[model samples]
Target: MAGGAIAVAAVGVGWLLWPSPSGRTLPPARARVYTEFSACLLSDSSGVSGKAAAPVWAGMQEASATTAGKVSFLAVAGPESESNARLYLNALVARRCDLILAAGTAEVAAVRARAPALGSTTFVVVGTGSSAGNLTVLPVAPPAGVSAAIRDVVVAASERTSPH
Candidate 1:
């Protein structure tokens, strides 16, 4: 099965990257190279506040390491107004993030309004919402759905779906 192959590959990679006597893991014979993709998260002014936001960001961070991509976050500096969130979303878009993750309610609303125009960028709402061309929502029911969506995006990035 594919899972068995992946498990073997992971163990092989671990062996190749085993720690040295100096405590630093050694590089593999040929390092796997990935594209310069970036996944950015948009949250409220106080950073991650809600329960789902932290886990969502953690998933993104873990994916970033696998894909050699960049993971960054921007918290709306003021109130959680849709307008304020729009400004921060604009900043992330300008940075050419391959995927923009909307965490807070205001951020998700702003993303919904703006995602139509930014059709080239994929926007993923970490909670429940509707889907557009480049925008999709992940339900917050079972925690695994969120993790699976995050994993899906990592595979997407690895497949060169990034708008980089």
Candidate 2:
């Protein structure tokens, strides 16, 4: 948890399902409920080899259990590339993930660029700063360590994705 910086990208579905008035008689809003959600973690080369990887991965598992969500990790084989990061993120979107955690600067940029187009998915950028459409950039300091930061991001993403 003491190595390179980490970022996150997530897809949030709760807001989309929440009934907003389009000036039509939408059906009565029922309480939103989520038995489970799917989360995707995108990591670049630095993240895979960094000391923080194991702890961050473990934290994702723990977060999954705590939030009742299924988590998947994708470690891109090559070094960081914005285009590649976008490709990976698009792949996760195709899988219909509710939340995405992108763990690097490149990944964060990719998520930021693509987030607006993916309406239902909530993108959480861990180490970056910005609030673009559905993308939530968490500028969390790493003083508590990368794993803890990742844990918090995942937990928040899961909560946001959940139906309330």
Candidate 3:
């Protein structure tokens, strides 16, 4: 009986002191590259029309030009409606864009629906109230100063999450 007790006590202590499985350790995540190899910009005509579209397109052009590699911009020219927005988004995905900049809630929602299959692409939404699976939101307000504010916010956020 004494030997049996000793054996039980030894088994209990061994179990208590056992190390956790090394395989359970999480692998480090890969570093994300913010640089764009190819990009597509999609916006509703109502959100970006007439004089308003010119400045928005100009801003995008300037930003793309500043990047290290060449960037292409494709404006989804069609009727300003939710259905058209979805079509534009689908076309953007078909183009195999590395990054997509969509403007407005409907467009963002459309992009979100396709994000599961389009996981490799990054979507940046401006002035939108919708969320995508892997989409990054960068809200921009009008008149001029807001662009600078959004730029600063994006830079700060990128720096915080970027792998050193």
lDDT of each residue in 75-138, candidate 1, tens digit only = 8888778999999999999999888998888998999999999988888886665676988877
Question: What tens digits encode model 2's per-residue C-alpha lDDT throughout 60-132?
Answer: 7777767877888777667578898888888898998887877776777788788888888877766646677
Better of 2 and 3 by TM-score: 2
When 2 and 3 are scored with lDDT, the better candidate is: 2
For model 3, residues 1-164, the per-residue Cα lDDT tens digits are 99999999999999877876774644788753455355566765554443333344445554444443223445556666557777888887788766676655556556666666777767766554565576776555673543443334334333433345
lDDT of 1 at 76: 85
How do all the candidates rank in terms of lDDT, highest first?
Answer: 1, 2, 3
Kindly report which residue stretches of model 3 are placed more than 4 angstroms away from their true locations once superposed: 1-36, 46-56, 77-79, 128-133, 143-146, 149-164
Off by over 4 Å in 2: 1-35, 46-56, 143-146, 159-164
TM-score of each: 0.72, 0.64, 0.53
Report how far residue 44 has shifted in candidate 3, in Å. 2.2
Positional deviation of 108 in candidate 3, in angstroms? 3.2
Candidate 1 local lDDT, residue 22? 73
Alpha carbon lDDT at 133, candidate 2: 76
